[model samples]
Target: MNKIFSLLTLLFMLIYLPSQANDFKAVYELAGRHFPWLKGKVDINPLENKKQGDAFTIEVVQNRLKIEATSTSAASRALDWYVKHYAHQSISHMGNQIKNVSKLPLTNGKISQSSFVPYRYALNYCTINYSFSFYTWEDWEKELDWMALNGVNIMLAPVGTEMVWYNTLIKLGYSDQEAKAFIPGPAYTAWWLMGNLEGWGGPISNEMMQQQVTLQKKILARMDELGIEPILQGFYGMVPHDLKKKIADADVIDQGNWVFTEFKRPGIIVPTNKQFENVADVYYDELKKLYGSDIKYFGGEPFHEGGKTAGVDVPKVAQAVQTSMQKHFPNSTWVLQGWQNNPSDKILAGLKKENTLIIELFGENTNNWERRKGYNQTSFIWSNVSNFGEKNGLYGRLQRFIDEVYRAKNSEFGSSLKGVGIIPEGINNNPLAYDLMLDLAWHAEKPNLDKWIEDYTVYRYGKRNPKVVAAWKEFIHTVYNSPVDENGKVLYQEGPSESVFCARPSLKVNPVSSWGTRKRFYDIERFKKAVAVFISASKDFKGSETFETDKVDFLRQVMSDKADLAYSNMVKAIEGKDQETIKSSSSRFIQMLKDQDELLQSNSYFTLNRWLNQATQFGKGLPDAKLAMYNAKAQITFWGPDNNPKTTLRDYAHKEWGGLLSSLYLDRWNLFVERALAGQTVPPAEFYQMEVEWSKKADLYKPAKSNKKNLARIQQDILK
Candidate 1:
C-alpha cells in the first residue's frame, strides 16, 4: 500500500509540474517584456494547489507576499495585502467589502514593492468619449487586462451612443449638415455630452461617428467577457439648438446661450411633448438594434452640467423622461450626477424611489453630500471625481477627505449610500488615485493609515527603508493634506477642482500659488528631513530597472516642488536686490528645469508638441505683446481659447513663454536682415532663410520622457 501511494504521488507531481511551470513562465514573460526593469530580478514562486472537489486552493509567496487563492477567481489573495497596506482607509474599506463578497482568503505577509497595476479600463459617459479616439488599442488592451486582474466587475461603457443620436437625427428629417453640427470634435466629447460646451473643435466626419460606434461595440464585447457592466446613455430630452428649425411646433425649453461661445444653447425637448417621445423611441430602438435590449440602467440627466431648464415643470419633466424610458425598457434606472445643486427636489419628488440612482459627485469637499442627502432621500452612491478635464500628472482627493467620507457613509446615513466609485473626467493621469479609489469600493472598514502607507512603500519599492516610509507618510500629511483658500473660503485640497486652472483663479496673482505652501502649515524642518531621507533612499535605485515607476513619478513631483520653492525664495531675494538671492534663485530654476528635462527624457515616447504650442503662444515673441489682449479676446470668444474659465499658472507661463519665443525668433530674424543689408553674401537669396530653418525646427516640439510603462510594470508586480 505504501509503495502504491508513493507511485501515485509521483505521477500527480509529474502532471502538475508542467502546468505550474507554464503559468509562472507566462507571468514571467509578461513582466519581463512589459516591465523591463524587472528583467532578471523578480522572484517567482510557483503556486501550490490543494483541491476539494471542483474548488481548489493555491498558495503563492515571495518576500512580503504570502497569499492563498481559489482556482476560479479572477484576482489573487495577494491583492488584499496591497489594499490593506498601500491604499487609503476608504479604499481599503472598499477592498475589504470585495474580499467578503468574493470570499477570497489572504495571509499576513508583505509583497515585493512595485507600482500598483499596469493598465486601466475607463468607461466615460455615452455619446461622449471612447477609448479608441483618445488612446491606442494597445493602451486600451493593457488597461483592460489590468482591470480584469484587479477584479473590476462593473465598467461604465458608453460607446455607440453617438450612433443612436446620429440615427435619431437622420430619421427626424435633419440633413447631414445639421446632424454634424450636433456632434463635437474628438477631444471635446466629454464636455459636449455634459452640455458644458459644444462644437468647438469639430465638424466630425460621419465615418468617424460610425467608427466610434464600431469601436464601442468591440469595447462592450470585451467588457462582457470580463464581467464588466456597460452604462448606456438614456434619453434625457437633450436636443441641439437647431431642433426648433426641424420641428416648429415642438415644445422645447431654451437651454440659454452655449457655454464659451455666442451660439444659441441647445434646447431640451420637453419629454411631455409627443415629438420628444417619438424621438426617444427612435433613439432607443436604434440603440437596441446595435447593443441589444438587455441594458437595465440608462445614464442621462435632464439638467446636465449647467444647462437651463426654462418653460418646463421640473417634476413633470422628470416624470416624463422616466415614463418614456419605462415604456420601452421596464424597471430601468436613471443614473444621475448630483453635481452643483442639480436633480432638484422637483425632479426627484416625482421619480420612483426604487428605480432611480444618483452618483453624488464632489463628495470629498462639499457638504452637498450631507446637505442634499442625494437630492433628499434617494438611493445614491458616494463618488469622488478626482481630476477634472483629465489633466495629466495631477493629484486626487486627499487621504483624510477619503477617510471622512468613509466614516460618514458608514455612520447613520450609510443605508442611502450604495457603494463608492471613482468618477474622474479623465482616468489616465494618476494611477495611484485610481487604484486607491477602487480599493475603497470593496472594503467595509478602514485601516490604520500610517501603517497602511508603510506597507505600500514596501510593496512599491520591493524593499522599503525607514526613511522612504517616513517620507511618504510626511507627503501624505503635508502635500496631500494641505488646505486651500477657494473664493475666500478655506477647504481641504481634494479632487480635480482643487488642482486645475478652473480651481485656481488667483494663480495669475501668485505664480507659484500653492505648490509648496504646505510647508507653512507643517514643520518645515521635519518635512525637509523626510524629503532628504526619501531622496537618499532613491539614490541607489538610479539604474535598478526594478524601481516602481509611479513612485518615481511621485518623486519627480517632490523634486519639482523643492525646485519651485527654491526658485520662489530666490525671486524674493532678487526683488530685494540681494545678489546672493539672485544667484540662488537662478541656480534653482535652472536646476529644476534641468531635472524636469532629464526626467521627461527618460521615456522615449514623450510627446509635448501640444503643450509646446500653447506654451509658445503664451510666452514668446513680438506676438506676445498682443497676448494679454488676445487672451482677453479669446476668453470672451470661447472661454479663454481653451474653454476653461479658471486661468492657471501654466496658462500664465504659456503667455510668458510665447513672448520669449517670439522675441528670440524675431531678434534672430532681425539680425539676419541686418547682415544681409550689410552685404554679407550667403547661399540663400534672402536674409529670412535662417528664420525659415529655425521655424521648422522650433515647430517640431518634443515633450519630456514619460515613465508610464515603468510605472505600470511596478504597479502590476506589486499587486502580484
Candidate 2:
C-alpha cells in the first residue's frame, strides 16, 4: 500500500501541473518554442521567495525538467539555466548556441538560485537609439527572450512616447509639421528623449509613429508575459523649444543648445506653473491611453547633461514633478539616472524617498553610490555603463563589477542597494562582460571567477576547448582588466579603449570618439597573445556560429592595435623625412586596413552594409527613406550640429565596420597619405564637407566578398 501511494505521487509529479501551466502559460510556451525538447518534459510550480527577491529551483529527474519559480521571469531564467548547464547551450547577442540534442541531461539533484537584490534592471536611454532604434517586432521578440533568460525584471521601455508627445502637442494647437519637427530621426531619438537635442533626424511620418505604437504594444505584452516591468517616459517639463511661440502665455524656460551651438534643446516648462499640471495631465492621459494604466515606474529628468538651471527653484520644481507623477499614477516610482550631477542633492531633496529609485549609472568609473551614500539612502541599483556610443571593443572591468557589487552590499548604505543592471550605451559587444554581469544578479556570494569562467566556456562554444579557455583567462587579466584605486574605484577612462583605425589621419591621434581615448591601460602584448590563442582554436570551431563571430571580433581588435604601430612608424618616418620609410609604412597601413576590412566582412555584425541596410529596410515604404539612410550614415561619421567642425560631437559614433573602413576611414587615410607622399598640403577642416556629402549620398556601401575561406590562415598571419 505504501509503495502504491509513492508511485502515484511520482506519476503526478511527472505530468504538468494544470495550475502552474495556466498561471505561467508564457513561460511554458517560451520553453516549448525555444527548446522543443522540453515541450512535455517541463513542469513549473510557484515558489514564494519575497524576502530573497525572485528565485527558482530546477529539478531535472527521470528525464523530465520540473521548475519551482517565484515569478515568470524566474521561470524563464530557470529554463535558460537548464539549457546552458544540462543542455549545454547559450543565448546571447553574439549568437545563440542551441544545438541538436538527442536527449536532455538529467541532474542528480535539484538546483536552486536566488537574487542577491530585489530588482534586476536593464537598458539605458542611449541604448534605445544606439542599439535598438530601428528594431522591428521580430528584433524585439528575440530581445525580450534574451532579457527574460538573463532575469531582467525591469527595463526602460520608452518606445511609443513619440505619439504621446504628438497627440499632446496637436491638442495644444500646434501644426502637424510643427509637431513632427519636435521629434528626432530614427537613429537620433536617444538624445531627443534626453532633451539634449530636438528634431535632428526627423520630421517622421504618421505611419512611422503608428508603427512605433504597434511595436511598443507587442513589446509591453511580451514584458508582461515574462513578468518584466516597463518604466514609461514621464512628464518632466520637456516641451518643444517653440512652446513660447505657440502659446504666448506658456511658462516656458529657455534651454540653451546642447554641446553644439546650432542644435536646439527642448524647452522645460516649470512644474510650479499652472501650465505644468495641464501639460502633465495630457501627457500622462495620452500615455495611459496609448500604453496602459498599469505602469508603476516613470523615467524623466531635468537639466540632463547641460541646461540653464539658473533661477529655477529645483527643490520645489522637483517636488512638483514627483507629485504630478504620483497624482497621475498613485504610488508609482520615479526613476532617475544617477549620471553626473543631474540629480543633484537639490533634486533629491524634493522627492518622496520611498517612491523614487536612482540608477547609479557609471559604477565602473565612479563611486557615485558610495559618494552620494547610496543615492541619499533612497534605494538605488549598482549599475554599470560599460559601453558608450555602442562602440565595439573587448571590455568590461570584470573584477571591478564583482568587487563593486560586493562592496555596495557590504557598505554602510548596503540596505539601499536594490539590484544590478546592464546599461551599456550599445549592448552589442563584449558577450563575456554581459554574461558575467547578468550572472552576478543571481549570486549571493562573490563567485570565484576562476571556476565560473570554466562553466562559461562550456556554454559559450558548445564544449570547452582548452585553447579558448586559456585565451579567455588571459583576456580576463588583460584587455578586459580594470585598474582601480585602493577603495575599488576605477581610474578614470571612458568606455573601452578606442581603435585608432577609426580615427582621422593625423601625426598624433587619440580616440575616434570625443571624450574617449585610444591608449591601452593594459599590456597590449598580452592581449595580442590572448587573441592568437583564441584564433588557434578556430580550427576546432571553424563552422560554429558563436566561435566564428568572436573570431572576427577578436581578430579585428588585434589588427586595430597593429595599425597603431604602423601609424607610429609612418609618423616617425615623416618626422625624419625618410621617403623610403614613409612609402613602406604607408603601404603597410593601407594594406592592413584592406586586410582588416576583409576579415570584418566574415560577420554581418561587423559590416557597414548591415547597419545601412537595416536603416534602409526600416524606412522601406516610408516617405523619408532616403533621409533615413542619411541619418544612419551621419550618426556613424560626423555626428552633426549642422556641419560645425568645432562641434566636439563629430565621430562620437565612429564605427569600424568593414565597408566603413574601406569607404570612409580608409579613404580618408589614403587621401592623407597621398597628399603627404606628394609633398602637398592636407586640408584638416575640409574633410567635414566630404563627410557630410558622403552621409547625404543615397548609395549602399555593400559588403564585398570576404576572405572567409582563408580566415584561419589570415588569423594566423595577424599573429605573425
Candidate 3:
C-alpha cells in the first residue's frame, strides 16, 4: 500500500507541475496580445530553486521585470500573485535574473535611460508637455509599456477633468462658448489644471475637449491593466474668472500674475457660494460616469499654482471642499503639492489630518516638509520635483538631502514620510539621478553607489568591461557630484536653486552652458579607449536593426561630447585672447555643431531641433517691449537665469540686450535717420545706412548709472 501511494504521489506531482508551467505561458500569451512588443521575448519559465520555493519567476532578457503574490491561498497563490500583479506585457521576469536587466548604456542623449528594480510597484510621474489630446492610443500604450517595464505603477493622469468641468458648466446654464474659453490650449493644460492661470491660451474646440476626455478613458483603462494608479485632478473651488458675469452676487479674488505671460491671472470662485455645491455634484457625477466611482484620491488645490481668494474664509473653504469630496466618494483623500509657500497654514489648519496627504515636492532643498512635516497631522510622501515642466537639464536632490531624508525616515519622523516618490516635471532628462532615487526606496539600507553603478552598467549595456564600468563610476563621482556656482558662490548641484550647468570651467566661475562643461569634465580619452573595444565587439552585429540603432546612438553621444569639449576649449581660448587657439577651436566648434545637426537630422530616432530652435530664438533680434511677446516665446523653449546655472550671453541677450541697446542707442539711431532724411526724400537705404553706423556705436560699452542695489533687487525678483 505504501509503494502504491508513493507511485501515485509522483504521478500527481508531475501532472501538477506541468499545469503550473503552462499557466504562466497562458498569462504571457494574454499579456502579449495587449503588449505586442513583448511577444516571443519575455521568458515565463518558473524559477525552480531551493531558495525560490513556490514562487514563479518571469524574466525579460532585455529589461527589468516585477513579480508579486496574486492571492492569499497557498495552493496556486503564487501563480495568482504573479498573474495579477507581475504578469504584464511591457515587463516580464524569467530565466537568469541578470538576463532580465536593462541593456541600454548611459549616454548624453536627448532622453535619459532609467530602470527600477523588482519592477512591479513603482510609480512614474512623466509630465507630458504636448497637449494630452496629441497623444494617441499607441503613444500612451508605449509610454505605459516603458513605465511598466521600468516598474512604474503610479502616475499622474489628469486628462478627463475637462469633461467634468464642462458638464458642471453646462448644468450651471453657461453657454458652451463661455465654458470653452475657460479651458486652456493643450500645451498649457498642466498649469491650467494646477489652478495657476486659466483662459490664457484658450478657446479650445469642442472636438479637442472631447478628444482629451476619450483619451483619458483609454489611458485609465491601460493604467489599470498595468497596475498604475492615476491621480485625477480634484475640484478645489477653481471656477471660471467670468463667473461674476453670470452671477451678480459672485465673490472672487484675482490670482496675482501669470508666469511667463502677460495674461490676466484667473480668479477663484468662493466654495461657499450656493452654486458651488451644484457644480461639485455635477462634476463628480460626470467623473463617476466616465471613470467609475472607485477613486481613492483627488489632486486639486484652492488658490493653486497661483490663483487667489479674497473675502474667503480659509478654514471654511477647506472644509467645504473636503466635505464635497466625501459627499460623493465617502472616504476620498486630497493629494496636494508641497510647493514653495503653498498650502498655507490657514488652509490646512482646520482639515482632518487622516483624509489629506502632501507630497513634499521640494524636499531636496526647503524643509517645508520637515518644518510643516504634515502640519503635525497627516501622512506625506517624500517626493522630489526634479525637472521643472520637463525642462532638459541635469539636476536632483543633493546627496546630503537624500542622506538626511533616509536618516529622518528611519527616525521618529519616519511615520510621516510614507514613501519616496519621483515627482519630476520631466522624466526623460536624467536617468542616473532617477535610478539612484528609486533604488533607495526598496533597499533597507543605502547602497554602495560605486558597486551598484557597476551592476547597473552591465545590465544597461548587455555586456560591460572594466574600462566602461570605471567610466560610469567616474561619471557618478565627478560630473554627478559637481557643484553649481551661484553668483561666484559654490553650491552643490542637487537643490531647488542649483544651476543647471553640470560642470564648471575651473571652479572659479560657473560655465555659461551645462552641455559643454559636462563633456569637458568627463575623461574623454579613457572613454574612447573603452568605446573602441565595445565598437569592435558590436561591429559584426550591426546588421541587426535594433543593435544598429543602439550603436549609432552610442557613437553619436561620443561624437557630441567630443564636439562640446572642443567648443568649451574654443570659448576659453577666445576669452584668453589666443587668436590661433580661438581660430582652431571656433572652426572645430562650428564643425561639431554642424555635424551634430546633421546626425540628429539624419537619425529618425532622436532630434536636437528643439534645442537648436531655442538657441536660434535667443540669438535673434534686439529686445524691445514689443519683443516681449517674442521673449515669452523663447522662454517657452529656453529656461531663464532664474534657476538655471547655465545662463549664457544668449540668455542675457534675450532678457536685457535688446532693451539695453534700445535705451542707449535707439534715440541716436532715430535722430540720425531723421536728420539724414531731413527735408529731402528719404530712401529706405538711407535708414539702413544710419542703422549700420548706430550699430557700431551701440556695440561699444558704456558705464550706466550706479544702480547696483536696484539691479541686485531686480535679480532677486527674476529668481522668484
Question: Which candidate leads in lDDT?
Answer: 2
Report the lDDT tens digits of candidate 1 across residue range 384-449: 665443333335545744675576666666667665566765454455555665555434466566
Off by over 4 Å in 3: 1-126, 130-133, 309-311, 374-377, 394-405, 482-589, 602-605, 608-720
Model 2, 338-432: lDDT tens digits are 98875899999998999999998998888889888787898998889989888877788888899889999989999999989889999888887
TM-score for each model: 0.68, 0.96, 0.64
State the C-alpha lDDT per candidate. Answer: 0.51, 0.85, 0.50
Candidate 3 per-residue C-alpha lDDT over 1-720 given as tens digits, one digit per residue, 9 for 90 to 100:
999999999998899867755544434544454444334544343333343222233332334332222211111222222322233111121101112322422212121111112112222222654212235565576566545443444567887677777777877778988887787655456667776656544455565566667778898877665556677777777777777777667666657655534445566767788777876887888889888887877887887655556667888898888899989988887877777777888778857778887777765555666677555655777666555534333344346335655765675667676656666654544555655665565455666777766765544444445755665554454434433355733342222221212111221223323311232333545544444544455544433333333344444445544645564575576556666765676556444433433333333333323322322332234222122222233333232322332233121111112122232223322342233223222342443333333322312122233344643342232222
Candidate number with the higher lDDT (1 or 2)? 2
Please give the ranking of all candidate structures by TM-score, highest first, separated by commas: 2, 1, 3
Worst 10 residues of 2 by lDDT: 705-714
Which stretches in model 1 have alpha-carbon errors above 4 Å? Answer: 1-133, 258-264, 392-394, 482-507, 510-529, 539-548, 559-595, 604-720
What C-alpha lDDT, on a 0 to 100 scale, does residue 611 get in candidate 2? 80
* C-alpha positional error of residue 618 in candidate 2 after TM-score superposition, expressed in Å: 1.4
Top candidate on TM-score is 2
What lDDT, from 0 to 1, does candidate 1 have?
A: 0.51
